[model samples]
Target: MSKILIVGAHGQTARIVIDRIISETDDSLVLFLRNSSRLNEYDNNSRVELIDGDVLNTDSLVSAMKNVDIVYSNVGGTDLAKQTASILEAMTKSNKKRLIFISSLGAYHEVPGKFGEWNEQAIAAYLPGFRESAKLIENSNTEYTMIRPAWMSNKDEIDYETTQKGEPFKGTEVSRKSIADFVMELLSDPTQHIDESIGLNKPNTDGDKPEWI
Candidate 1:
């Protein structure tokens, strides 16, 4: 019966998480996306309410957050920090505490070896924003869990492991389904990683970079 708000509803990772939520729980969901037309696929889902709005607009974010119990942010890109700022402001105004955010693994420059070097070079422009967004959540009063996932793949499996914020990040290439499963686990028990940032990766993989990459 919990009401959860999902921003960046059209994202691949968000879709996976939403599917898992719909299939496993009775929780009502509010999906926030910039374009309402993109919600046609979910028209028959009674448990989902689609809200059209930009995360950069605080008023729109606040409106979407109304009566929302938990907020799941899957937004990325260079504007991520700005969007996160708006989300934090709206959540504070609405008195919503719980947040689950998706970030990238090398955002902290924690990934080591060749893959780490490659990731840094590849996303050099995006990492700073991700890092800033993480700091924003860390300093906020709300209960937040930031999930920094390793290189992702379309692999059809849900096998992954996690590393704490300060721990050295390990492994590479976790499936989107695995990340979704982890999010589902957190949704089932919100108290699991309160105010903690975690890095996720596929287990037992030993390589500098993901094979596919």
Candidate 2:
């Protein structure tokens, strides 16, 4: 069983992915989060281990990378660039290669049309951080798959499609379950989409903006 490490284990989609990982695969998991106690229910799960640590701390990140075959970063914040640097530095120090990074739409200005403009205005504050994180990951030596999910929703379904880095992003929102399902697929085949940035959204979700907004 491959050992996978999940940074930012408290994220909503990450939680779905975690539950699926336990139920569907035999892989062992190391869950790292700032507040590990938030998931205290997993304490006795044999295939899971929890660590409370900061993603910005390279030393702590390197320690967590030990014996970890794959790393999934579900973190996002205003300091995402710094966090990405720390993750990359620790990966280099630990001699680990495979990583799955969760970025956001518009990080590369790949979102198109009126919807794109709307999204830009909606998340302008966080765009710089996402862009910087994308830059660092794209320039890194690690085998990385960066996922840029569209505006998120809590819908209870998994129906999504992808666009490559240079392709125009489709749709305005996607269910978090869809993103988790895609991440689960990547976990099953680490070699798929290596060093690629993918845009994910529910098929047929195209619009100027999400329906709710």
Among the numbered candidates, top lDDT falls to 2
Residue 161, candidate 1: Cα error in Å is 0.3
Worst 10 residues of 2 by lDDT: 116-125
Candidate 1 lDDT, tens digit per residue, 1-213? Answer: 789999999998899988888888999999999896787788889999999888999889898988888999988889889989999999998889999999989767788888788888878899989999988999999999999998889889999999988787898789999999999999999888999899999987758678886
TM-score for each predicted model, relative to the true structure: 0.97, 0.98
lDDT of 2 at 74: 96
Which stretches in model 1 have alpha-carbon errors above 4 Å? none
lDDT of 2 at 104: 99
Clashing pairs in model 1?
A: none
